[model samples]
Target: MSLPPKTALITVGATAPFPALISASLAPAFLSTLSSLGYTHLLIQHGLTPTNFGGTPSGQSLLSSLTNLSTTSPLKITAFDFTPNLSSEIATSDLIISHAGSGSILEALRHVKRLVVVPNEDLMDNHQKELAGELEAQGYLIEGRVDNLPEAIKKAERATFKHFPRSGSEVFGRIVEEELGFEAEG
Candidate 1:
């Protein structure tokens, strides 16, 4: 019997482009690591517009340069700017490597996918780092750095995650009822 193909999805969100995370994810070493771990496909959401930094290449251009460079590896690489159906993409993937945006993180977790979050350190105030760190500490996900993605990938492969409650959870409703001194119907 043959095992099913494993697919990993990487999303950089739609607002700010995270070129470093995109670059690191496509690095030869990282691709090799993913291939070794049985990830047969890699899908990247690289963001829509190029960043305004002088001389900094857009994620699409970076992807164009390296997309063909992995011919020796068995991983099939695909990339896009933005999509309205990202939730479906996340639902179909076996592993998710994401920028540390709350919306992206929550969406991945909502689908119960294995997640590795790489927070962009260049953002102002750097709250993404704090959020990723807290989630990692709580065992909900693995917090990864662009410089050490291969190590992070290995760790995430062996680590199990806690169940993230789905949206519209009863926990909040129960709290509200308690606060209002409402009695249970039973």
Candidate 2:
């Protein structure tokens, strides 16, 4: 019996929509590499980035460009602007390539998926580079600039990644409360 093909999920956070960047600038080289590496399915979630693609016809045009790209790649590609159930999408993927947004990174780690983070470098005070750098140092994921995505993905596939530790939200919340000087009501 034959095993099912491998799948990859890619996301560019909604805070800075760059569907066009991924579709036009990044996908061709990256997708071609994945296809050569035996990935059969590719899914991309392009979020709403106000500066680049939000509230304009350019966003639709970018989406159109992605759909057009899907037809030509060797891998079966599905690209979209957003999804309400991101966890479900993460659960279904074998590999994840995403923006270095903390939310997306945590979700992918929680699922223990092999991950490659491509930090969007255009936003002001973007903390993604720092976060991705820290995670990569710990053997958790691979990080790269968009210009070098194909090579990054290749490195991630061969590298060893340790399991991510479960987070303590209650402790985190308490820290936030303390920082805000919230007094407990007796």
TM-score of each: 0.82, 0.78
lDDT of each: 0.80, 0.72
Error of 1 at 72 (Å): 2.8
lDDT of 1 by residue, 1-186 (tens): 966899999999999878788777767788889989989988888894353312223334554544455565688888788898999999999999999887888888889888999988989877778778877887878999998999999999999998887752464344335434578778
Q: Candidate 2: lDDT over CA atoms?
A: 0.72
lDDT of 2 by residue, 78-133 (tens): 76678989889999998888887777887898899989987777766566676677
Leading candidate by TM-score? 1
- Local distance difference test, candidate 1: 0.80
Candidate 2 clashes between residue pairs 3 or more apart in a chain or in different chains? 16-49, 17-49
- Give model 1 RMSD, 1 decimal: 6.2
